[model samples]
Target: MSVLELARAEIRALVPYSSARMEAAGGATLLNANESAWMPFGDAGLGCHRYPDPQPAALVERLAALYGVRPAQLLVGRGSDEAIDLLVRAFCRAGEDAILVQPPTFGMYAVCAHVQNAAVVEVPLAADFTLDAGAVLAAVTPAVKLVFVCAPNNPTGAGVSLEAIDDLARRLAGRALLVVDEAYGEFADGASAATLLDRYEHLAVLRTLSKAWALAGARIGCLLADSEVVTLLRRILPPYPLPRPCVAAALEALSPAGQVAVRDRVEVVRAERARMVVGLGALPGVRAVLPSQANFLAVRFDDAGAAYRRLFQAGIVVRDVRRYPGLQDALRITVGAPEENDRVLAVLGDGA
Candidate 1:
């Protein structure tokens, strides 16, 4: 049987959630979806009444141009979070299929697996937050449908070696999909895994506008893979997933001017990250500040709980990554504005 045929029958037969937007037909008429035909005036001038395009064409075209890939290979979603969920549902069979994830990384991979009732197989990263190819290969099984590796990984901020990723993709060929989450790829020094899409049919890359493009509020994310894979995953995405305003905003955000702005912001963030690492490293309780290729720093403190409390009391929020394997006493701090970073440093220095 084909892989789709072998997929969960429930998913095969599953009818997805349909919205007013989904049922709308193409025409000049304005009756369907219960939206106001006219635009609201004054401050609310932008007409948000019309349902957005199901697959935003302009955004796709612009993203395709930016990533140097065909538009057919891209699927934009609410965030990488939605893409993760959709992939798991479309490929994995509940109780029978599984996904492989590397730890000291993002939690959503395991969460998505659980949501789909698929088991999660973990291959924790080495002490330096790098992949262990042998450990990963050993963990693979026939039931494993996806292998998720976050590059410039969360909590650790280190990029996975390109060779390791290529090797994993080669090893998993014909057995499972290799998903590389490159949410922070923009901050890295080299090209992204998106560049390798042409060579690997089962390889997928997840990117977000939240980190680099500074569009977290727009809720934009991109999934780039082989067109066939994108087709399969698209069947499960919400119809009219991109709102009209969001589409407009994202289109604007992907323009030449937008690209320049994003690049400038990334440079600022990278500089701020360096400043944070240096400043935080000098703190009395800090143990180590790991090298990072992304816009955040993973700081190891003498007592994570105390540092967490101190930061919280100072009105600064940082992620406590103590739960991650090999990340005990570590806190993941985002690179904020200079003033914000200084505030955090001041609080940490004051022993608060």
Candidate 2:
């Protein structure tokens, strides 16, 4: 079954908005979209006065190359949040269709589904934080339109194996779209799920510069899917999803110099993560440091409330994930710079 068939009928039949920019391009024109003739202050050679391209072509090509996908298969959005929201809105009909997600993972998947008034089916991961393929496959009903699986999952800091993801995709074939949020793919040890895109037509991968690339404030993310799916999402996306400065920022982040800089940073984070796991594990009140393939470590403390206070007192803030299922005494800590990580270790040793 093609994914397009699973999409809402209204969306399949709807006509997209045609803005002035979409109508025409590439001419020495004035008075077309009606804007100021002067460039804004602090333009920085990116021409901030003019509205950004509805779809920045060059940036699209750069990202496609970086991810090993064709340009036509990519859809750029504000962030993974927007892509998640769009997938829910485009496929799941209110009060009818549903999406599946695993608990102790990213919350945005459920939040987006709830905002769209679609049912969210929770399939909690196994006790070890690994995917229970059989349970997930058994939960796929005809009403389920999308399934979200986060790799190197948030809060827990555990990764789902590619083989498991591949098996699940085959099982859900023609039934639902399998979305792999690879937000921390760069920090992982192996290849990305994007390598499986050509094999599974219903597969989609979400990527962002917020984590490894270190551009959280820019808020740029991408959806890598089949060309048909890309075309459908393009229609529903806002006419101008990226602004001039954001486009420039993303381009620079993907450049040769930027790539080198980010790689260096990734090395630092990875090294610090190892040091943290050992350091925090030996702490008095710490129980266990869950294995992590991402930039952060999820630590289970004997008394997380007290640990949180110690870190807070030292002007260090980390995520308290006690509310997440199976993580009552866990706190997620990002692997920061050497000095910062040392500070956190020092504070935790203060016996607060």
Candidate 3:
């Protein structure tokens, strides 16, 4: 019951398309792929005109080292969103195979499944916004090709139990690929699921530089899994998925100085998150501030609409998560800079 058994048969047998860039490497004159003779104007250090490496080698090495995995075990993509889409395409056959998700979780899991015309089975999180591991394991069926778990889950901000997740992965061994979306792992107070990859051949971890690294606009994400699974994703991923500039930017972000800066920033965010929690707790009409291991906090207000308006009027923007299942009166607020967090406190306190 290997994880590969879960991948669509067609994808496993299909020979991936070989682009012009994939055929050859640098030599003298580049006449293979049609391109302008002259470089584009306003060119920075990055050779934007040339097709970047189908998979940037140096960047892959850097990320693999950072994530504590071998270079061969990673697949870099546009962002975690692209990784999510690739997983669905490779495993779930349209109208046949299915994927499971824990709702009030990341929307893209369901969105990508829908785009692939695959079935989506949702097992809602507990009222405390925690994973019901026993329930999630029971929901697995032969049709389930993928299972997405968002730890320190978005909007909810509660970190799912790692022990429970480990047990679930052990139970689902060979039945489905257990995908742990650790987008907010940097803020959490626990080890990553990547540590379990050595044991669980079916485990997949999605990480990004979007949040803690302050590179959201750069849109860099990595899918860490079994080397074989990584190769499967590569087969279907678009050639030249990353631009030259993006590769350069990510390299810089992973350097020693950049890492130190990210750590400093993370500490500031954690402090601000605490301050925001305490400040919001004192405000009237605030029902609860759910415990969070992520950088954001999910605050339940007695009147979410009024709370939203109050913040909007003050030019402070936070995610209004009322429409999400079970989050009717909640707002997900990312821990911002000191000044920004202060403004939210001032506005909300005044409203109370």
Task: Tell me the spans in candidate 2 whose CA falls farther than 4 Å from its real position.
Answer: none
Query: At residue 352, what lDDT does model 1 achieve?
Result: 32
Which candidate do you rate higher for TM-score, 1 or 2? 2
RMSD of 2: 1.0
Stretches of candidate 3 off by over 4 Å are none
- What's the lDDT for residue 284 in model 1? 93
Question: Candidate 1 lDDT, tens digit per residue, 159-236?
Answer: 887887888888878778889999999998777788888888888999998889888998999899988778677768
RMSD versus native structure for model 3: 1.0
- Please provide, for model 3 over 1-352, each residue's C-alpha lDDT reduced to its tens digit, 9 standing for 90 to 100: 7788999999999899787688868677888778766788988757687888878889999999999999988999998999999999999999998999998999999999999999999999988889988788889898999999999799799897678778989999879999999999999887888888888989999999999988888889999999989989888999889988888889999999999999999999898999889998889999999999999999999999999999999888899999999999899988999988888888998998
The alpha-carbon lDDT assigned to residue 330 of candidate 2 equals 94
Candidate 1 error regions (>4 Å): 1-26, 30-34, 40-45
Error of 2 at 173 (Å): 0.3
